[model samples]
Target: MLELRKINKSFGSRKIITDLDLQIEQGSILCIVGPSGGGKTTILRMLAGLESIDSGEVLLSGQPFDPTNLKEQEQVVGVVFQDFQLFPHLNVFENITLAPKLSLKQDKAVYTKNAEELAQRLGLANLLNHYPYQLSGGQKQRVAIARAMAMNPKVLAYDEPTSALDPGLSQQVADLILEMKQAGMTQIVVTHDLDFAKRIADQLYQVTPVE
Candidate 1:
């Protein structure tokens, strides 16, 4: 469903990703594992269209995908940053429902249902009305996941989904990832946690510096 062909990204004298190539099959969960400064998150950023590719291309569903086009890219992908980017003032449901309502112009019913359903699915049913400040670290991350899932995109790109949470919460998040995979949510998770990646990813793609 997704393909990255010879993707190249650089910063000044430092080239983060050089001639990197990857193919993510439809309905498959892929995990990218690498140490810090190894260009793991850089790859995800490029995939999400947040960063432009200096060369090559990212293809989705056989079409050459360009992240530079925001509208087109937003329609096809939902991304969860390592830092939960939820609105501090908005309640959990509101945080999850905002994107669909504002960006997609989805009906109120659709937004409500999507938020409620994902909240329940992500074990955030009881925290719907809670503000980000009121929630614990784990709850906040789940809110972030729920917000990402609420978009119902073709692919969910997770960048360090569990890096901040405690072990127990990370396990919970891992279990939720398993459920998402079972339900056939095509995902690409960029994480340093190899064990977590192994538990969730159907295939693993390890990125490294080219000698």
Candidate 2:
């Protein structure tokens, strides 16, 4: 389980999240939806250990790690950016394996097998040698998903996954989220797309600004 208790965050003097609390069971999908600047992304950033938590705690299972320490949470969760941030110079296979190899220090053979399996599952098996520039928007998004899965993290978070896709593509993304859950991957999705959220979310969190 993942739990965020009374979490608070700020950027300089501007507070982003205050007194926020959330709980997500393993293998479930949770969608955080609200207007822009409601600190949705900040919540994900804190989960990914990319932002500092000002107060409260973030827990995985029953373990709490320092939110400011990337090393503490690096292997516990993975993130997929909205832009499908694949490396421009690396091919699909390379991009997917890079983090696992570098961050986790997994052997090349290990990450190679992992990447190939994720690519096949995500329908990118044939695009292994293709670079980001050659992929369509949907394909790029799939590649991003594959990249995140390669880390074998217990939880995955996506930022505005449907922002660049048409309705049909958005539905596909929702289907993939369900597939991930069936495969026992916990998910935290931050999006303004209500229809997409309704299609996949097992739990929906509406985040409003804290005064």
Residue 171 lDDT, candidate 2, scale 0-100: 76
103-180: candidate 2 lDDT, tens digit per residue: 888898898998888889999999999998999899999999888877777799999999988767887888888998
Candidates' lDDT values, in order? 0.84, 0.87
TM-scores for all predictions: 0.93, 0.94
Top candidate, metric TM-score: 2
Candidate 2 accuracy as lDDT:
0.87
RMSD of each: 1.8, 1.6
- Tell me the tens digit of each residue's lDDT in model 1 across 1-211: 8888888888887888878888888888999997888889888887776778899988888898687686731656678888888888798889998888988789999889888888888889999989999998888878888887777788888889888888777788788777887888888899988999988888898877533
Name the best candidate (by lDDT). 2
Candidate 1 wrong stretches, greater than 4 Å: 209-211
lDDT (C-alpha) at residue 46 in model 2:
82
